[model samples]
Target: MSERIYSDYLNEYCKDSSIFLVKESEGRVKNFLNLDQEIPDQYRWRFSDLNSIVKQVRSENTRQGLNKIYWTDQSRNIEAYIIMTWWRGNELVRSCLNGLNRREVIVPAIAARSLLELSTVFLLNANTLEKNFKKIMFPPETIVISTDIENLVAKMIWGTRYQPKDELLTQTNIMTALKKLAKSPGTKDLMPTYDFLCDIAHPSFIGNTSYWSHIEVINPDGSERRLMSRLTDRQYNTEITDKTLWALAWSSTCIYNAFIIMRDAYSGLLKKI
Candidate 1:
């Protein structure tokens, strides 16, 4: 096949501002078996199902007949879910940034936790794509295995949030899937960073990453703690503060890495077509 250029698709679909691209996004994520909860306006661009995504994006809204450009059958569900997870995570990160830019008062704990979750979702997407790509391209036993991995990854990704179980995917959890993701040239920082990300997401003592204070108390051993300080009213506003910037940096980098990996994987498949 001739070279397939997917740059435009990547650019339009992979960014954070994409949350603004929809009038509204709603549906029950059947993959997770979660109730069809309505999506709030802030999450207007998120979708967890591949079947619903095509109709909403092209046939339903744009009238652009682009459904065939994406996977359409049960056989390709894994590929579709991988893209959906990454894109959804991308938009989520972007939405948080947009809210920050607007100076909306946000709970840092919530923001930090959300960023941590998005990072994990992206990592999971990468793992899913790597594990199933060959299975996706072949036949018979490959298809069966690919389908199972795809569905399992799908359920694992959403199940983390929805808490429902799919009997088929329950054999192995998402943590296992994450561990199976192939190492990437640039993904070395993923897991180590994720360690700290968890703290920010959970309610651990160190996880309450907001309102820090620092007093350089040299102990009897002459050890000094990190130079941390609480944000004062006189400091550059919360959104621009060092802590907030670090959160944004972590979120954007995680999202971008996921996007690049997802984008490359899809582009490779497109070339095979």
Candidate 2:
């Protein structure tokens, strides 16, 4: 198979000023990608706009050049194609992680702690500002997680996968860790961060992966292979109460400690290396 070149696709999709290419330093690219939320709109355009631009570019490309090109639309609602940059050396790190078959790799303990701390700072700032000055009051309505929140988590997980010897950390583990950290006497200020993780870790908020199975018999001995069909449901049931809050707090703590242990192990290996 031929190697997939990102630049080739860029050339095909990026025709006019609609797609702006920003050059970023290697470290900055990783940092931007690992942030807990999507880069603000000031950083990128909406995905809808990007798609419109791509469609226009493709039509123009087809008429000018008869080159057969295949491309995949990996953009999400929170992503903007206008702010894309080519990170030449980053693919090696991605390739290394891909070989390990891990998803949402664990961040270093220090990094994780720092992230929580930063989140706490943001929440505290917002809380303080809101308390000091009354903002426009909005009526209570259904609380929906913003696309920014989902994209932020996805980017953080995606970037962490490239960390050396990173372990896959599930949403459950992350919640457990945050809860533990929150309960610590010294971590009172980080309560908001703990709550945020708990929200993401709730089973109802997580994606489901159950499906139907199909069997294919290959031998007279009755050996068979099972094929599963993908299915999706839109139903959601959530119960948020004092009891649930207490449970989430406890689970967060467990996850925090688990992450600490993993970090220590990784550090030990790094020392030897």
- Candidate whose TM-score is highest: 1
TM-scores of the models, in the order given: 0.45, 0.19
Q: What overall lDDT goes with each candidate model?
A: 0.43, 0.31
In candidate 2 the C-alpha lDDT for residue 232 amounts to 22
Give the per-residue lDDT digits (tens) of candidate 1, residues 107-193.
433564466555655666665675555445523222222355446555644454344565553434434543444264644544544
lDDT of 2 by residue, 183-223 (tens): 75756535653353344444433212123234655678778
Pairing residues by index, what is the TM-score of model 1?
Answer: 0.45
Once superposed on the true structure, which residue ranges of model 1 sit more than 4 Å away at CA? Answer: 1-87, 95-106, 134-145, 156-163, 170-244, 270-273
Off by over 4 Å in 2: 1-107, 135-273
